[model samples]
Structures are given as structure tokens and as C-alpha cells.
Target: MTTGTHSTTAAGVARPGGPGPLADRTVSRVGYGAMQLERVREGRAAAVALVRRAVELGVDHIDTAQFYGDSLSNEVLREALRPEDGVVVVSKVGATPDPGGPRPMRSAQRPEELRASVEDNLKSLGVDCVPVVNLRRMDTGPGLRPEGDQVVALDDQLAVMTAMRDEGKIGAIGLSSVSAEVLRRALPAGIACVQNSYSLVAREDEEILALCAEQGVAWVPYFPLGSAFPGFPKVTDEPAVLAAAQSLGLSPSQVGLAWLLHHSPNVLLIPGTADAGHLEANVAAGAVAFDDATLAALDAVPSRSQDVPLG
Candidate 1:
């Protein structure tokens, strides 16, 4: 399945996207997002089984955060996987459980705080060092600009990750929910990947995705199904996307994910599902292919980024 830096199908066909540049290893472009593990009604054992199935289906990237389910995601991953499973585990820092909300995320941006967050992830995941760690910008949500005083320079946060890398606590660094301008400034500091909320109907990060491709940074897009935004139209509801799916005899989710893989060679998918059946369906999306007509139809779907802002 693997040859040098590329992962191929059993028939020797090339995958939709090539090997990720960050880990520099053979990896499937379609990856598993671990945030929904805690929401599964069957509880921890079922969550662990879903993770195992993802790997069995050839998933080579798993994205999680310490704050996801108050560290439940990483804990479940610890029970299900070992480093030898040959997958990259990516976690993020800069947000912690908010004391005010029923259960919301808050900023935790100091260097010491970031360092502690990294150690917390290490402890939870039971890994000597995570394959990749992303520094999420928490001062502002994904769609809005930050207040003048709230801005935290990328270099300041990079210093924390750089120190951790020097000490052998992390193998690579990444950025999440940041603007293209910020990514341009941060590239000199060394970024292996960039995580952002992008989907068939949400394209605000479009420029950032192109920049990542140009710079050889992996672009990991979360919420590819458009379900993360509770108020907006789901990808399945888009007329063009729905039509394409009907024509191909595929689910709307599969059509949406296949479009992302066709959108860019650097784009990496992290679609998440709590149910085992949904997990397998998400992985099967990797096989859906699009012709030029389908690609154009998907591209015309309106951008829904304004409907739901990510923070």
C-alpha cells in the first residue's frame, strides 16, 4: 500500500492527494477527525473500536485536541492506538475549557501555558512526542479580525513550539484557524501544516489553501461535511452537490469529500463521525472520483462562511 513517500490503492492506482509534506511519510489524504469520540452514545469502548476501524481502512492521519471532550478524544486514542500503527497524530493547543460557559473553549496563550498544554497532550495520548502539533489562534474566531490589543504575534507562539521541538517533545509544528496573512508571516518560523474550517459551502480559507499548496504545507480542513455549523445549510443540502451525488450513486458526504481531494493536491480531509457505520462511510469517501463537470458544479455552490463563524 506504501511506496517511498506515497500511499497507493491495492490496484497500484495513485491516491487522490499525494503524501503529506509535514510527516514526509506515505499517508492517506482522507484522515480521521477524533473530536466526536466523546459524543458517541456507546461510550469509550465503542469510540476505541471506531478508531481501530479507521486504521483498518487505511487512515494515516488522526487529528485531536486536548480540549476536545475535555481530553476524552486523546484518551480514547491512547487505548486504541500505538505509534507502530503507522499513523500521524496531530493535536492543538491555545484553547482550554472555559470556566464560564456550560462547556466552551477559552484562550490560553502564554508560553508557559502552551508548554503545559503540550505536556498534557503527551500525557493523555501516551506518546513520547506527537507527530504534529498545531497552534490555534484563539483571540478571534475563524471569520473575524481580532481587537488590536488581543493580537498575539505568531513568532511569540512559535517560540514556545520551537523550544518544545528543540527538547524533542514534538516532531513538527503547525497553525490552525489563522489568516493567510498570519500564515505568510509564520512560514519563516517553520510550519509543517495548517488546519482550518473549510468545506464545499464554506470557502473563506480559499486563499490560505492555495498558499499552503505553494509552500508545501499540508492543509487539513475540518468540518468537510458542513455539519459543524449548526445554523448553516449542510453540504448534503446544496443542490449542485446533491445532484452530483445522485448521478454518481454516492452519498452527499462522499461527494463533498471527493471534491476537496480534487480541489488541491495539498488538501487533507479530517471528517469525523461518532458512529462506526458513519466512520466507515467517511473513509469510503476517499474512493469517490469527480470529472471536470462535477468539479465545476461543486465549485459554484455558494460560500456559507458568513452564515456560521468559527471561534
Candidate 2:
């Protein structure tokens, strides 16, 4: 797979520019998520193929994590793409899979643990220095708390990453599943992006989204298709979402991606899928255009929390 294989906007058509500030290079508004690739039916080989195809389709940003298949996704990326190829692979630390428990993951927030996570990601991706490392907050403590709940303070985590950055172990810092308040507090540390649970049907992070826009930080939303888990109502299940997709002659998922791109300049879509066809369809969603009426229809969709936000 190679860059410049295709253009999202057709000639003579007004191409929409990505909103908000990003890194120095041009990262496509649409990125590929590496989580599902780890669990693909065809396993690692299929995962590697999808990453290559995504890069070929101009997807410059690939969101990954060491916990995703115990660094399975990063390994696929290392095997598929060269580190010097210039695609931005953003990874996260702070939580790891709980192999012995029913819980999805357990926190690894200690400075030493975070340092080890960063090293694992670097080694898995075969890169000397990672472009970005997100301090994914695993929990906000036990209870129903307001936004920006901090189990582990941001300053302590950033301090460790700052030292690593100074040593050239990582490039910039980012946060995952953090609130606006937490973000404001972390301003002194400098943030490059924020990954949070947001979609047409999940709108709890509006303030966070608005904050990122105001601060010029990239907002890369995970679960953009609603929730990946079963028994959850997907974004496509919403009446307004279905109606708009039918009228616009696009799939509900495609319409969802288009809405996110139109929602804000800093909003970057990293929709993931295991199927090769689905991956192609996701890349094509970047080209799905919308006008004022369509945008309004999508905006009116009701918000519903599928489950508690994950790190």
C-alpha cells in the first residue's frame, strides 16, 4: 500500500479541509483503528493486509494500543509498514488487559508502569520514537462523578512522559477518555490529541469536543459507530440516522462518519472493522458529503449511553 493512491474529493468538487490543528504532515481526516484488526477472523495475516490497504487509501493516522490483543495490533503494523514510511501511529498506555478477571482491563498508572508501556509500544511497532503516546485513564475512581474524574492525576503521568519525550522515547503527549476539566488542568503539559467515546448516538462529550476545538487539539473519537459490543443500539439504529442515510443514498455507518467530519474541524474519524470489504467501505465514507439539512438531521439524533466509557 502506498500514499497518494486516491483522492477523497473529486476534481472540480470543493474538497473539505480537516478541521483543527494536527501534526506537521497531512493526516487524512479519516484514520484506521487497529483494535478490531487483532481479533479478525483470519487473524494476524488479515490484520496486516488491512493496515497496508488503509495506508494505500491515504489513511495517515492509525490508532492503536498495547492492550489491543496484548500488542497484537502494533505487531501487525510493524510487519506491514515501515517506521520511516511517515504514517502516524498513535498508541496509548495506562491500562492493560486483565487476563485473569471478568473486567476488560486493569490500570497500570504508576510512572514506572507507564514507562514500561511506552517501551512495549515502541518495541512492538519497531520504532525508536513514537509520534504520540496517549495516557489512557483507566478509571476516575469508584462512583458516579462529574467529568474529569482523576484516579491518577494528570501531572504525575505527564511528568513521566515529559522525561521520556526529552529522552526522545516519544514525540507528543495525548489523553484518552478524559474530561474537559482534566484537559484544562493538563494544558501546561501540552496535548496533541484526545481520544474519547463519541458518536452520533453518544453525545456526552460535547463539552470535551468543544474544548478540543477551542484549544486546537485533534479530537479522535473511538466507537464512532456507536458501541462495538453486542446488545447495544448502534448509531445506525437511530431513526434519524436511518432516514438521513436512506435519503442521502449512503449506508448508516457512512452517514455517521460524514456527520463527525462535519461536526467539527478537530473531529477525526478512526472507524474500525475486521472485514476487508468493511475497511474499504470505511475509507469510502470519508467522501460521503453532506449539506446543511442533512447535518441538521444527524444533529437531532438522541444521545444514549450504551455503557460506561472505557479508557
Candidate 3:
């Protein structure tokens, strides 16, 4: 489920005491996900332009996937990027490519198969080894996996990734679309980041986010405005958020993003946008500052819980 609630940062987010991996990483706390850059021919140029613009604007992190167009997105990534400073490329593997596009297909963890995925992304993105490698598990399917099959054994995925890392094929290890228990079990093996659905309305990742904060791991919450979910609550349209946006003369989107930036230093938002104007607006949300009263007011909303939370 998704909750489209929106609000702004409450005062200044806890800044990095000094320099840290999560803080010093290339992408901004509010970074871009390159999935939106795919679709048609015209989209390619716009995506390239957006990547170039994002770098120029000090946005460092770029997330993509091998399943995205079977390497089309990777090609655009390399085309838009330069041998510059503070740029960390993060990509995921697991889903197979389809003729129409990348779909929720299946997961296979053979070492040779992973190698093929890597070769494709590396050649397309033109990178030796991407900074972050996200292992996308296949837990979403018809009839869903039984308890025994639902859980992906750590040793299995770790074996493949550990080999790849040792062979200098990946930098940091991360996971997407996983439960808190699964994440906890996988942490000891070197989980640098975790991507889960989290928001004011969707508290599925709430505990996971706090754990990441405690463990000093970066927590990347996708769909900040709640787009991935079907029945997610509308945070942006909430009475409190609407009132606050009206008070600030800001759009509902800006207020929503601002709330995440203010949520916690451990929270890293990767909102996807292809519209040029919307991209700039989304990035600008990273700079918003929410006051104490405003934070309270937004938090006061009686947000509904997610229908099927992994928390």
C-alpha cells in the first residue's frame, strides 16, 4: 500500500557531525532514480540531459537497474555521466528483462547469471564496478512464496555477491524489497543500504529505518510521494499537509519531500521524475526547513497504516 501524504522538513535535519559515507556520498539526500528516463526515443535525450543537470546541481547518486530496458538505461547513464568527483552509481539485479520493459519476472542466483547481469550493466554504464549493488529479491509473485520459499537464504545470495565483490565486480552491498527480519539476518554479511517502502503513512520501514540509523547504515526509501503503492494514503492531500503547503505557498509535492528531509538524517529519498520542471522542484525540496510547530502539525495527521507492510 502507499500513502501519498506530504510535509516539509522540521527545522534542520541532523547534519552529519563530520564527514560520513552516507553523508559524503555523491548523491544528494534527495536524489534521482533513473527509471523514469526510459520509455520512448525522446525520453532518452531528456534522461541524458537530466543526468547531466543533476550532476551539475550537486546531485551525486544515480540509481538504475539492468532490467530497465535490458541495458538501455545503463547506456544513457554512461552517456550522461563524466569522470567527475563525488559520483556514485547504484544499480540492482534480479529481475529479468522483457520485450515491453523490465517486469516483475523471477529471481535466479547462479554465479554465471549474475556475472552476465554485471557484464551488461558494466558495458552499458561504462563503469568498472558500480559503487552500490542492490540484490533485488523476487518475493512478489502469484500465490507468493510459502514461508520456506518466501525467505531467501542469506548464504545463497551472499555466496554469489561475495564472489563478485572479491572479483572486483561490486563495491557495496544493498538489498531492496525485503522485510525487517530478512534485513537483520543479512546485515552481518555487509548490508550498506536498504531500500523499502516507507513514509508517514506507510510505517513498514519505520523500524528498519531506525535500525539503520542506529547501525549507521543508509536507508533509501523509494517513492517518497507514495507512487509504488496502489492504496497508499494521500499524505499530500491530508488536511494538515494541505494547510501547511498553503501557509508556505508551496506545492503539495515540495511539502511532502521536505518532510522526509526532516524525517531523519538516516532517511535518503530517491524520488523519480522525468518532467524537467518537476525534477527541479523535487530537488529543491531537499533544501526546505520545517519548524517545530509545523512538524507537529504534519505528524498529527491520523495516517492509515499500509495494507500489506513488511515491517
Question: What C-alpha lDDT values do all the predictions have?
Answer: 0.79, 0.76, 0.67
lDDT: which is higher, 1 or 3?
Answer: 1
Ranking by lDDT: 1, 2, 3
Write model 1 residue lDDT over 163-207, tens digit each, in one string. Answer: 999998988999987877888988987899988877888888888
Q: Which candidate order results from sorting by TM-score in descending order? A: 1, 2, 3
At residue 131, candidate 2 shows an lDDT of: 89
Model 3 per-residue lDDT tens digits across residues 1-311: 11122111111122211112452252357667887777534667777887777665556666888877667778888888777535677888755575553444345445556667777778788878877888765342111132444354656877888778788888888887777777788888888788765666565567778888888788887666654555557667677788888888888888887887677776776677777777778777766777899899877766455535331
The candidate scoring highest on TM-score is 1
Q: Which runs of model 3 end up more than 4 angstroms from their true locations? A: 1-20, 23-27, 39-41, 100-105, 109-112, 138-152, 307-311
TM-score of each: 0.90, 0.87, 0.83
lDDT of 2 by residue, 1-311 (tens): 11342333222211123322454444678888888886788877877888887776667778898888877888898999865445778899887767686665567777888999999998989989898899886433221222432355677888998999899998888888777788889867888898887888888889888988988789998889786666666888888888888998888888888888878878877888888788777877777778788788788888876446444
Q: What is the lDDT of candidate 2?
A: 0.76
Model 1: colliding residue pairs:
none
Runs with alpha carbons beyond 4 Å of true place in candidate 2: 1-20, 139-150, 230-232, 306-311
Summed backbone clashes in each candidate are 0, 1, 21
Better of 1 and 3 by TM-score: 1
RMSD of each: 3.1, 4.6, 6.8
Worst-scoring 10-residue span by lDDT in model 2: 7-16
